[model samples]
Target: MSITVSLLLWVICLSCHAWLQPGRYGLPPPRPGYRPALWGTRLLAPVLALLVTTRHDAIAGILVWCMTASLAGLVVACGLCFGPRIIGTDGRRVARERRP
Candidate 1:
């Protein structure tokens, strides 16, 4: 059971980390400083998983950690993908959108 849980966490962490990369497998010069953030996700997932699972007996603690990880992953992905949309999106459509 612990093995399964650990593998699941690794998969989830890497997958979430992938989302943070801009290009294919983070190739072709990813956005500056993105790699460090990705590494953090990679390291954090398993540590957090272990921390939660070992602190309590049986599968309940693992389940709690799973829930927490899922929620956190959702937040990170959403924030990265839709961050620009949040700027002044008061149901208003502008004639000219700002460009970087």
Candidate 2:
């Protein structure tokens, strides 16, 4: 079960990372720093999920929890970094169409 959950989490994280790659949504190319943070998030997600599921050792479990929290934080950061542009553009289109 732990393995399956870890695999699922890894797949989701990888998909999200791939979707954020250059030209995925026709967005401008990402800055170099962006790649490392995004890749690190993708790499850590599976390890965290595994730790959460296989919490046999106390110290290991705590470390996994910390990693999971970091993963969540990175996800939030990614959203903040990219979400506004998508939302802002969509909102502008809707407003323009509604105008007289």
Candidate 3:
């Protein structure tokens, strides 16, 4: 349960961190009002996850947090890599140009 919570928090953390930098992902920039919220989520999730995991298990909480953080980071990285191809600027599938 704690691991699951940690994984979810890390996912939220990494996704927000990525979303905060829209140009890198080719994502449209979010409204200015959302920047603070995104920053807050990007910063808060990991700390909350740490607290939750530590409450669950003293000896293994750090280990669990590290494992889940790694897994969530990979998931987010793959999303960044493939997401642009899957969904373009106009929210449509990006058509591929063929070459002879």
Query: Which numbered prediction scores highest in TM-score against the true structure?
Result: 3
lDDT of 1 at 90: 40
Model 3 worst lDDT window (10 residues)? 84-93
lDDT score, candidate 2: 0.55
Candidates in order have lDDT scores of: 0.58, 0.55, 0.85
lDDT of 1: 0.58
TM-score of 2: 0.38
lDDT of 3: 0.85
Candidate 1 per-residue lDDT over residues 1-100, each given as its tens digit: 6545655675668565755543433323346677677778788877967775767565676676666566656655555455543222243432345789
TM-score of 3: 0.79
Write the residue-wise lDDT of candidate 2 on 1-100 in tens digits: 5444554575566545654653443234457777777777788876677665667866655555555546655664565455534323232322113336
For each candidate, give its TM-score against the true structure.
Answer: 0.45, 0.38, 0.79
Ranking, lDDT, top scorer first: 3, 1, 2
Give every collision pair in model 1.
Answer: none
Candidate 3: lDDT of 60?
A: 99
Candidate 1: lDDT of 18?
A: 55
